[model samples]
Target: MATIKDVARSAGVSTATVSAVLNDSAYVSPPLRARVLAAIRDLNYSPSLAAQNLKRGRSQLIALVVADLANPFFSRVVWAAEAAVAAWGYSLVVFNSDEKPEAEQRILSRVRMLSCDGVLLVPVGDSTKHLQRDPDEKPLPTVLFGRTVEDDKSDTITIDNISAGRQATEYLLDLGHTRVGSITGPLHLTTGRGRLDGMLAAMKSRGLAPEPRDVRSGEFREDAAYSVARSLLEQQDRPTALYVASGLMALGAMRAIADLGLRCPVDISIASTDTIPGIGGLRPRLTRTEHPLVDMTNEAVRLLVDRIRRGGEVEQRNIVFQPSLVVGDSCAPVGLR
Candidate 1:
């Protein structure tokens, strides 16, 4: 194994010079830098990240923890974060909390110990037990992504679900839908609950009471969404519009609608969240709420890097993105028969 000393000797430079060149700590002559690079290549020397972190008291790695990797929303969020972090010369480490506070806590502890630059977490629940809740003692620069809870102080980046939900339903209302329903994700997650709140708010605003029986909660999976939607479609007076909280769930909702010999705008209208781009092809472009994950991620990374570069106490900041409704063939003007 070629050590720093070996590279220094081969490059005919002092160990300190080699260190500065590798870490970009200080300006090194181009010739000297070139020599050091050549030596490193010839020796196949890899810089010791641990040692560098120890010396600087911080790591150039940002940890992003998500509740569920299965959710395309989270996946897209991570993808956006990755793109943004690299621009600032920082790397990202993705952790799947798996909706478990215990796992989230373990990962938090590990990230803290590793002296990571910062952390972006989508908390499983409202309580951040895994992370010490005090902003003054905030062990690190941490931002909560997509999941908002009790801690308003921690940096949060999420779309206003309530607003999005309201918007989705309002679109259906504009299309002459009076009996509107919704399929939400787990009530345990804030996103799910918040979206539900939006649906109710929209209904109330329009002088219609959102029926509880019409609303269903699922695991944010296609199967659960499918079964729930199928059951709903079996009702005597089925809902005219369904605000599906996810793109994946929309697929199930569409399938259920198809099974019942229903058509969009003709029978039931759908307004879903997150295009997800790849997995499923939503025909004629389903009316959807754009999550703005790419933009949110850019801000998250910017905040993380800023916190690391500029010394500051643990402070909570929230950046809420407003979702845009993309009108498509999935929704239509209801026919009064």
Candidate 2:
């Protein structure tokens, strides 16, 4: 109800003086500043964030776009990115695309309207043409998190998913499981394609080839993965070991295994590329590759902020973090469990 003009009138000071005192843009006498503060409290005046941002020429807001917020891995990324951005005196707004390119495009259009200072985007598949700006237009400061697009001109932060996939598959192979199957993410996305490629490469290294039917697309959804995994497990020539591309998919496959009245490692071993918080407490701890969540988030935020500050003057950076393997109870040597 109260405006800056009302505060200025109540404090017997010019509106410019009140503005200077509130924004700290210019030095005001201590007594005048005290009077302005007192008048602001008395008037219950609250500054308009839009007006403030207009005056400062910045919103001090960052947009984080993720494929699936329901996925714990993205949740961890949101948590870390929020903390890091808050420490830098900015706020974060999160958007979920549900792994759809059209949804991602809609979100980006909304983000453009918001005048966000920067963006951290985990792209959906390879559809990033919407992110490309005209040559004459100044590009939005953006950091691509987790996924990359072809001919990408923005900074990127991601784990080595290919290596992670290979490690998970190779671990099962080393344990003497020749018949290995996989539930892969959507192959349109690099995360899905890269991990599956790694798994296949690992299989090829040992002169082994998985049957075409053994690999199914989970589409990065738990329910889809559940169905795919259940079908895989129902086959007469089921794989002795299974490799999952993501933690969420792994959980689904585990549930499918339970529903089938089968035991992990005893009936069929399992390994995966990622794990979320609390995954360690699962009945049979998942054997998987772990991402540097904290480090990746910190770097993503830092890079976005730097890009926001430096704009086009900064060089684009592509940062890839290595994944670490955590062996757990879910995997066992073939015929030994």
| Residue lDDT tens for model 2, 196-244 | 9999999999999888889998678678889999999999878999999
Error of 2 at 272 (Å): 0.4
CA RMSD of each candidate after superposition: 2.7, 1.9
Q: Rate the local accuracy (lDDT) of all candidates.
A: 0.83, 0.91
Candidate 2 regions off by >4 Å?
none
Candidate 1, poorest ten consecutive residues by summed lDDT: 276-285
* Model 1 misplaced stretches (Cα beyond 4 Å): 11-13, 23-44, 133-138, 311-315
Which candidate number has the best lDDT?
2
lDDT of 1 by residue, 1-337 (tens): 7889999999999999999998798999999999999999999999787877788787889999998898776788888888898898888999998888888888888888777878888888668755764656745777788878785556788889888888888888888888888899998887898888898898898799767888999987788899999998789887878999888889888888888787765777889876675634656468988777788888887777777766466465778899888888888777642
